[model samples]
Target: MKYISKNIVFSVLVLSFFGISSLNAQNDNSKIEQLIEKKRNYNQTEVKSKGYIIQLYNGNETKAYAVQQKFDEMFPAYTSKMKVDLPDWKVQIINFKTRLAADRALNLFREEFVGANIPKS
Candidate 1:
């Protein structure tokens, strides 16, 4: 009877130790998860990088603006910008994060703007 009680006590202590440790582990995991979420939010809000840009039109200012207006009407989801470089004016959709994303945009734009492409940089 004494030996059985001692074994039961030992088992209970071991189980309690593991249970406490598991609780601590869960707390640690929650802290880690919070930190990761914070970092993700910070990255989204603070970091800004110029990724891929697809040039839709490259010619004179008048034609570039015309293309920009047409593009705005066609792809309202995307934003376009006009840049003046020397004698040429460029109308582009900017801030694509990956080549795959740019390629997808290119495919969509290609249906309307035949000259749409992702320029090599």
Candidate 2:
């Protein structure tokens, strides 16, 4: 019947679409893996190299999160860490591959705090 043929054709088209999408998804994932392999490897020594240190209020995760969000927006490739001490929280951003990159992030973060913040190598 015409109805049966039409239904079969529609089902075949949907199945084909899903099949093609799955192959495309796999290809995209492979490209991402290759790029990750190419990115710089971060180690403890590099982490200690040079960075920017900003002290936030104790238990003030809200501000840290906000600052992190802003920082990530400007320097999506940078790394950061948060340390807690007796009555204060310290946030440091480091492992920058170049001074220019580090300086750029420091300038952007200055939108929140300004002073002797960034530590240069």
Candidate 3:
């Protein structure tokens, strides 16, 4: 009889714990939802702007083309283009609106290239 009563008491304690946790979970979810709504409202007034790009390479047409292809394979997310201006071939990443944003990218590219510069657009 004592064994049965102890089992029953344990079961009730476990059930109460789960019930209390579920209530707390619901409250947490409501708070998360409210925060998300607030963030969405704040982002509605966000502004958009333009920046500069980092020049990766500049040399012969064939060499620049190969470098551009390799760079594209390495960083597919960035816009890498090759242009011919006079005697040199230009490989540049364009449209970096902010100096801070451009500098962040410049630091990453500096590991691979020595001539990475954030030129204005």
Candidate 4:
């Protein structure tokens, strides 16, 4: 009877050990999921501010898309946007608030397309 009790106790301990470990594993997975969600939200969220616009195109949808794609390929760090401003398909680069910043970005852009300009914004 004492030997049977010891075997039963050992079985319970082994089962409890696995049960507690599985619970802790579940808690760890929840924490990891929450961290991943926080990181994903940070990357998707955008904050707005006043800035300059560097005009690259003012007409022709096909030509504007081509230019936008080319700009994106060359400067993946900077965002290139295309919009319809009625009577024209507009392509522009945004977020350069200062003349020096705009000029510096323009210099890089000019290396590929010499005609890129930062109009009054």
Best by lDDT: 1
Q: How does each model score on TM-score?
A: 0.58, 0.40, 0.55, 0.56
Which digits, one per residue and each the tens of the lDDT, describe model 1 over residues 44-97?
786445688999988998989999999999899999999899799999999899
Q: What does the lDDT read for residue 80 in candidate 3?
A: 92
Candidate 3 TM-score over all chains jointly: 0.55
Error of 3 at 36 (Å): 32
Where does the lowest 10-residue lDDT sum fall in candidate 4?
42-51
Off by over 4 Å in 3: 1-50
- Evaluated against the true structure, the overall lDDT of model 4 is 0.84
Ranking by lDDT: 1, 3, 4, 2
Looking at model 4, residue 67 earns an lDDT score of: 90
TM-score of 4: 0.56
Clashing pairs in 4: none
Backbone clashes (count) for model 1: 0
Q: Taking the tens digit of each residue's C-alpha lDDT, what string does model 4 give over 23-115?
A: 999999999999999977975574344677788778888888899999888889988888897779888999887667988888888887766
lDDT of 2 by residue, 52-104 (tens): 44332224666766666666676576666776664655566756566666676
